[model samples]
Target: MRKSVMTGVGVITAVVFTGGGFAAYNLWNGVTGGTRAAAAQPSTVATPAAKASAIKAPSAEAAAAGAKAFLAAWAKGDFEEAGRLTDRPEAAVAALTAFRTALTPTALTLTPTAERPQAGAPMTFRAEVGLPGAVRVWRYESAVAMVKTGDGGVVVHWDPTVVHPRLGAGKALAIRPVSSSVPSQVVDRKGRPVGAFPSIAAVLDQIEFADDGAQPAGDGTGVVVVGSAGGSGGSEPLFTISASKGAKRQLTLDADLQRVAEAVVKEQSGPASVVAVEPSTGHVLAFANNPAVGQNRAFGGATAPGSTMKVVTAAALLETGLTPDSPVPCPKNTNAGGRLVPNDFTDARLGYTFKDDFAQSCNTAFIEAAQLRLKAGSLPAVAKDVFGLGLVWKTGLSAFDTDIPVETNPEQIALAYVGQGRIRTNALAMASVSATVQSGTFRQPVLVPGKAQPMAARTLSATVLNQLRSMMQRTAQSGTAAKALGSISGAAAKTGTAEVGGQNPNSWITAYRGDLAVAVEVQAGGHGADAAAPAAAKLLQLGNSH
Candidate 1:
């Protein structure tokens, strides 16, 4: 207060001096706040805690819907649809299509259980497909594993089961007896045991009996004696039959001829089936698939008859008053349902008499004579009744259902006359036709040899039969089949080439020597002459020699 009075404040100086510098101290404190008090206030903005993302669990309904759609698509052979439902769509389509093509199911039932949801994961389902009486089911299962993919779906991964582990490594499980009563032994025509009748325990080494246990008989438990002895400790009665137990009798099949035929078939056919059957007796002499054993093209293979079926048309026409000598005008091309039917294989127009047409395998001639000229409506029935083209014979072997797809239209009939329409037959059925003509009656083709039984007697008139035979003879001598039967004496043959979808044709030749009727087929090969006829010639030579 002593010096401040005059410095800067005149009025404040008196108050400041009186207050003993209290005002001045207060102002100084406000300007520079205390650091300690400010630091004591709690932090208003807090640091965020570690965040965790919430995962979604798949719904059972969605998973089930996917599984159902997958199965339906699989059944319909729609691979693409099936794929979309799977986690790995591309892989699923490929695997499913392969399964569909490989497995032929008599019955298929798929039952998918409730979806089992994994913890914080996608849902999954279980399905069981029952394949009863499967030959290689175990192998199939081993090669394939049920797996759920990352996206949430199921698939089968191949894992084949190990074959016979203990008794025989390579061999499959031996047939076993389910009951102790001893099932009747299977015997061949010669009274030989067709195969080993070892007790299931004997072949398999260890077998569990059914709950009923063994049946009681005169001596000990009534187990029918199997193998070399009856349980009675006596030598098993050897029936006077020349057959022995557990022995496979060598068939009459000529192994050398079979090799040649198989080789030729492999060389010529592209994914084709070849079957050589004894037509008169229906004995399947040689059944071979082009690729090898399992392709199943011979009896099961089905294809359009093409012009080769004209042989049946010719026969049908002859049955209905038209003969090889019947004067039927063969135009270069006959109009059929807006499409022109040309004369001969070249699709060229030519004038052919009935015989010329038959020898040349003329489509226009046969069509004009069979469908247009003759009783058109009667052709199918005539084919069924006379030639047996659509007839399903009881060969006691698995066969494709032969059909003459019902044709009510003129175009269809024309196509049928040339074997291009709905008409379909397997090698066995076609051979039966040839055999019927040769034997003057129809005999069921027999694969398991025993006694040949007649399914039906002669359905064609003797005159019709003779005329057909004569025409076939002419075919062998100078027709499309002439070269096939050229060197063979007493061999009457007809060669056929059936056209398929832009594929190499199916060749067929059926011939008979004395009691043996043979039908030879070459698929995806050349004409009947090059493919089927050569095989027939060789077979005829072998049969004649025997």
Candidate 2:
């Protein structure tokens, strides 16, 4: 036996009893209808069975009403009420939640194309979406299916396609960064094309493609609407909305110096980078990388600075009443923080002056001094308070600021004093370090003119600056950097060789002449003087000529 139930009030056509079962027919002429069961006389037992059926289906007007309520609730952001109007409440709720969360639309509007009843199960509407960095609204046609329920009412059929026609099951909407159209060209300080210099092309690409809108004529970055099953990366872009602000953008780079830097790094045997800064104004004169295709290592590299960190260490000691000529001990190797530390130089002197240790790049002398006289917070404090090492930089480009975390371990602190453990910097930041020592002030470096710069907390004291300059000058004149610096007059420098376990050490050199300060690095280069110093000297020479 089969039984059927009909909803709403309706006209009853007939009722009959057969084979110990009953059948009823519901007939309607467009009004509401319901089914009723009544006992009937057994007159047709063992005869053909009759089936119950409804004569009328829901009208198009009714489906439109149901869709109106659901869409109204959704437009008001009342997702729960909207879900209740759908056939699958749970699925509808989840999809709606995901739609709002993923797109992050600043404004959303859904308007039905026609208010009049439509002769279709799926109702169509215009979906307009707005985003934060987008220049225009994204508009498209979307639809939902209206279905009749067992309760004799209509409901919206829940499906991912209801949210977006192209949206598939288990997929989501997302916004991603696209290259902008405005500021179409990047130029140097003198308005020459920056793309010509392959050495700094990666950096120029980042700035040109950055998603910023601060400049009135710079439209920053473009945005795209994508339907993705995974993260933003590898997503399929469905629509692109481009923005426009300016025609061209200029940087603070000097063309001649940039060419010199590019040429110098090209001659290195391994990966190398050079960054030059103007000491007085904190302008980045030039920055270059040997293989300029991948990462912009000149500004974003995070590696141990080796003995170049002695500049900060020496400053911290100078704050403690130690002068340049103060007598200090330089041992071949000494136990520091439970580890035997040694200097690059083999000769051990009992009364080497502080100047001698700095000029000779003595690791043991610095380790011993820090172990006895300094605390864990001493170096970080001096780095932040004086030279602006760990501050947020707004250089109008992608850059990795120097990171020197405060350490409590004696071993780590000892290593940090000589710039080995837990200390990381880039060529750009090291150049800024030398610039600060040259000018006695920490002027934040800038690539794009008029970008806001972070204020340096304090300037190096006159006494400390003078002594550091004297020691660095001695380094260039008669110490490790002597041959590399050659005849560069009025120059100061410090050389570094950072060990990386099984790999050859990274060679480093930071130096300044007149108003120009430069830093050079050669990855897997054996010694600072042999590799990095020559490049630094060449860049400093070209930079000073400007």
Candidate 3:
């Protein structure tokens, strides 16, 4: 692998592990020279020491040479060198970084599945890599893709998953989240019990009073908590609630919808989240974090929301003199506050309306409109007063506190229109925005009873509301989200791709149909149309079916 690679042949080898002990390693003669076990090898007869080895296909010879070179580099614990043999060495290097050490397979053997291996055929191999901080070997089935080099040698067509299946830019394969022991219930809007959601489980609490008999003692107010640690599941107490006084909270989650969402999210490979609500009322019908990984990211995450925030910006634009059909400039890029903002793929200057820019997700059009049509400090009002952002929402269980701060920086203001810079929100908040648009009024979201109603923000005028809905509908029918969300009747949607530095931008989709509104996010997912929108479409289909 460190060399410029081989040509003309390929070989498939099964790396039979000797379990990485000092004794076994010396016997195998290290990486390439010897692979047979002394016990497994048959005694060789002196007579007729076999003429020449049979001729190998050029592709097979090249593959075998390539595999051996990679194995040798790996044996020296030179993963960096071995990485170079693969097509995607960058991804390979990233995945290999987790091991923090170059490792050799203690034993190796050639087990050719095909007589003469050809380029691009996968070679199955078993390797017990010497992972750092552990004596016991880790065993797994891994395959490498072989491609023909220009000189006729084969090189691995690498995927990061080859190092470890879950290893990617943002993911580390070796570490994972612990399963929750405590349980909590998520119910639908009408107070029907749903399943136990991980988000609710992460912040759930159970209280138990030591002494149960004494008149439930002082109105159950000052009981000492004992033997408790809380995080996910149903909020049922180990002891009786009348005695222990534990809280049994119900969430606005529909069981059927949650199951459907979970099923759809599982079919996808990356991390994702879905927040669905009953639009007429801000009641969550289903909330699911993809694979239920990490923290409760669905309810508590704060991401830029890509173009989805255009919903908020458009609302602000209508408040100004501009109508949906108002002419707007969406050149390739526009300057605002001395900072340039580019439309990702829009050309509104070729004669397009504000509504056209919106459906097409024109970034510069909104930035120009924001500077020319609206005054400074207007977005904070747009977010807080109209969209019900900035309020400390008490959604029964623990939840994300949404923030959309006003920006004085010209570039910040320009980017905010496209949901970059400082505009951060969770799926719950975005779903609420869609619900407000769907219902023509802002409904304060409540996960449990006793949620305080924040002061009423300025309501959207009837004309503005009609136009907003129409624009969203237009987006679903012919815009970016159309490929994913167009089939459903009476559907309206907005897709977003929030840019995160270095890695891929977060994918976002906020949509509403009839009384149901749903928001979805895919972390490090490339774009709204390619990544987030499909997840949203699946959830919507299942939500409607249920």
Candidate 4:
């Protein structure tokens, strides 16, 4: 009864090629619910399994034959004809449309492992898809679903995913940048480039893993489970179907200082990040990380700043007309807004000057100062308006700008003085804070100059700056940071330990030399004095060598 569908396709196609014959074929398709004319019918989106079983069954051999013919047509770029053969014609057309527009494919070819199901599953095949120039091919696994016809032959069962399993909603069979493009050479203050470090190179052109929107090339096509990690380096995404290297980009990174920072944090077991910027120009002198640069931790991590924030809080107190010599209290803990803010091993020296409290990193002292002396209502403005802490910076590269939310909770306000309670910052931001103090004004750091312009900020008064510098000088001389920074002449630094929901708190240190400002963080590395300060000293020494 359906012998006409199984007769030699060449002869059948010739007979069906006439105008009247074509219209009759379309009508029969509509009447019998065949897929070839689905586009002319109503649109329906079905899942893979639903699509596979939509059409009635024919003969097993006929289905295999139909699969072979479908692959052959699709391989030769007869997308319209091949789409007409599927249960959902619109889906196949949509896939073809994406391939043409987005993939920018020049040529494509499909080949089946078996002409008929001799042993394994039927319709398993490979698709060699070419990019713009047809110079490279992304060999993709593809197949066609075959269903039995009511009479005796088989029709191709079709789903758009037959092109690529990840081609559904929210996913696409696309071409994207695995590694970002780099322009010329990024340089330091003196025009010296940090030599090609694998870590730095990786950062310049980020190598996105396979979890991104890239499909595997040349993975097992037939007999492979859907969504399983494919081939070798399963998590590795194919950069592009073709390769086109871009111009070498330049950066404002210092090679020598970067090496010193990398060497210090390279041996650490867990994640660590360090950044060094020039105080006068706000140029990024050096950047290093233990996990090797894919995650730009130095410029854009939203980690809690911990006690290192005291430097900014101190600025607020100084602006409130409180002198460094003003007397203040140091207690173990202060409970406000039903929350307790405690110092690191807080040893209460009931009466201490503001200078002594900052040097010792007394948490409660600064908390009290934030509310009582500085006027809690004006706390947030100190960092944002005065020092440019929370303002949006126009850094050339991607950066996590500081987020210092205004605090209404007394406990939270106290926590804010100590770098907690909704206050978040990145290494670049903290380094800028130190730089602002050292330079007496804010200068936003930049990777590529002129690309990111800096915003003007309110500067500290000369007297206030002198006193702040004096306080930090005392810190390096005999306070919490003294042990690590004692050897470096003129070194002034502050240390912090931020609680990050774990057994150990994250360690941090922001330091400055004559013209250099550096910030470092060690995730879950305990006390800042023990983990972050030593690394800071080493980097400061290297930058000073210039």
Write down the RMSD of all candidates, one decimal each. Answer: 28.7, 20.0, 16.1, 15.7
Between 1 and 2, whose TM-score is larger?
2
Candidate 3 lDDT score relative to the true structure: 0.61
Off by over 4 Å in 2: 1-182, 208-246
Candidate lDDT (C-alpha), each: 0.49, 0.72, 0.61, 0.65
Estimate, for each residue in 7-40, the C-alpha lDDT of model 2 and write its tens digit: 0001111222233222322222211122111111
Q: Enumerate clash totals for all models, in the order shown.
A: 15, 8, 25, 19
Q: How close is candidate 2 to the true structure, as a TM-score?
A: 0.63
Per-residue CA lDDT of model 4 for 256-292, tens digit only, reads 8878878877866688888888888888777788787
Q: Which ten residues in a row have the lowest lDDT in candidate 2?
A: 2-11
Off by over 4 Å in 1: 1-264, 347-351, 450-454, 544-546
As a whole number from 0 to 100, the lDDT of residue 154 in candidate 2 is 71
What's model 1's lDDT at 463? 81
Clashing pairs in 2: 8-33, 8-34, 9-33, 9-34, 10-33, 10-34, 217-245, 217-246
| Top candidate when judged by lDDT against the true structure | 2
**Candidate 1: TM-score?**
0.57
Write model 1 residue lDDT over 18-84, tens digit each, in one string: 1111111111111112342332222222211211111233354444344444444444434455445
Q: Please say which candidate is ahead in lDDT: 1 or 2.
A: 2
Ranking by TM-score: 4, 2, 3, 1
lDDT, candidate 2, equals 0.72
Q: Estimate each model's TM-score.
A: 0.57, 0.63, 0.59, 0.63
lDDT of model 1 at position 270: 61
